[model samples]
Target: MPLALDVLAQVPTRREAVREEYLRRVIPQFTGHSIGEVQWSTAHGDFHWANLAGPDLLVLDWEDWGTAPVGFDAATLYIYALQAPKTAARVRRSLAHILDDPAARVAELLVCAQVLQAADRTSFYATLAEPVRCHLQTLASRSA
Candidate 1:
């Protein structure tokens, strides 16, 4: 995955997987922090289990792959891994370089907002709602 990301990171694109407009509209509603300058990079935008394959780390679904916040992929994977404690821990450990950075907070909140917004629309993320909310609270508090 690191190898793939390293290569993907080098591919240039004017596209933004997650636009500043979207972040401005959704993030502050949850974190109460205004979106400012963000560090952008190429990412697998939808880096979740469904988009990944076993033993060899084959990342599928390139439709959303493009420029995004630096930690977007890690944050998305981490948020989805929340229901499984072990997986969440592994995600944090493996991506500590990105996840531990204070700057990644915005990406985390951006993902949390997406999860919450999806929860509002359907039952797909109902089981994840509370966990995502709790995470949002944690992220918001950190910014305080």
Candidate 2:
């Protein structure tokens, strides 16, 4: 996954998977930090299990590949992996360089907001709602 992300980082595109405006709106609502600025980079906008393959790491769904918050991919994969504690831990560890940084906080909160918003409309992400909320609260508290 790291290699895939590395390669994607080299690909160029002007698209923004997570727009600054969206972050401006949601980040403050959730984390209480008015977003000053976001670190953007090329990313697999949708970096979840369904979009990845085994044997050799294959990242599918190029449709959303574009500029995004610095650790968007790592934050996304981390959020999706929360259902599996061990897997989530591994992702957190492997991507600690990204996840541990304050810059990644925007990505994490954005992903959480996406999940929470989706939960309001469908049950697909409902199971993750609480966990995501807990994570958001933790982040919000940090900023406070």
Highest-TM-score candidate: 1
Superposed on all Cα atoms, the candidates' RMSDs to the truth, in angstroms, are 1.9, 2.1
Q: Report the C-alpha lDDT of model 1 over 1-144, residue by residue, as the tens digit.
A: 465665776779987798888998988775555767788888888988899997988989988888888788889999999988899989889888888877777788888888887886778577788888777777767777
lDDT of 1 at 3: 56
State, as a TM-score between 0 and 1, how close model 2 is to the true structure: 0.88
Find the 10 residues in a row with the least total lDDT in model 1. Answer: 1-10
Give TM per candidate.
Answer: 0.89, 0.88
- Which residue pairs in model 1 clash with each other? none
Per-residue C-alpha lDDT of model 2 across residues 12-97, encoded as one tens digit per residue:
88887877888788766754556667888899899998998988878788787789988899999999988788998999998887
Of candidate 2, the 10-residue stretch with the lowest lDDT total is 27-36
List, in order, the clash count of every candidate structure: 0, 0
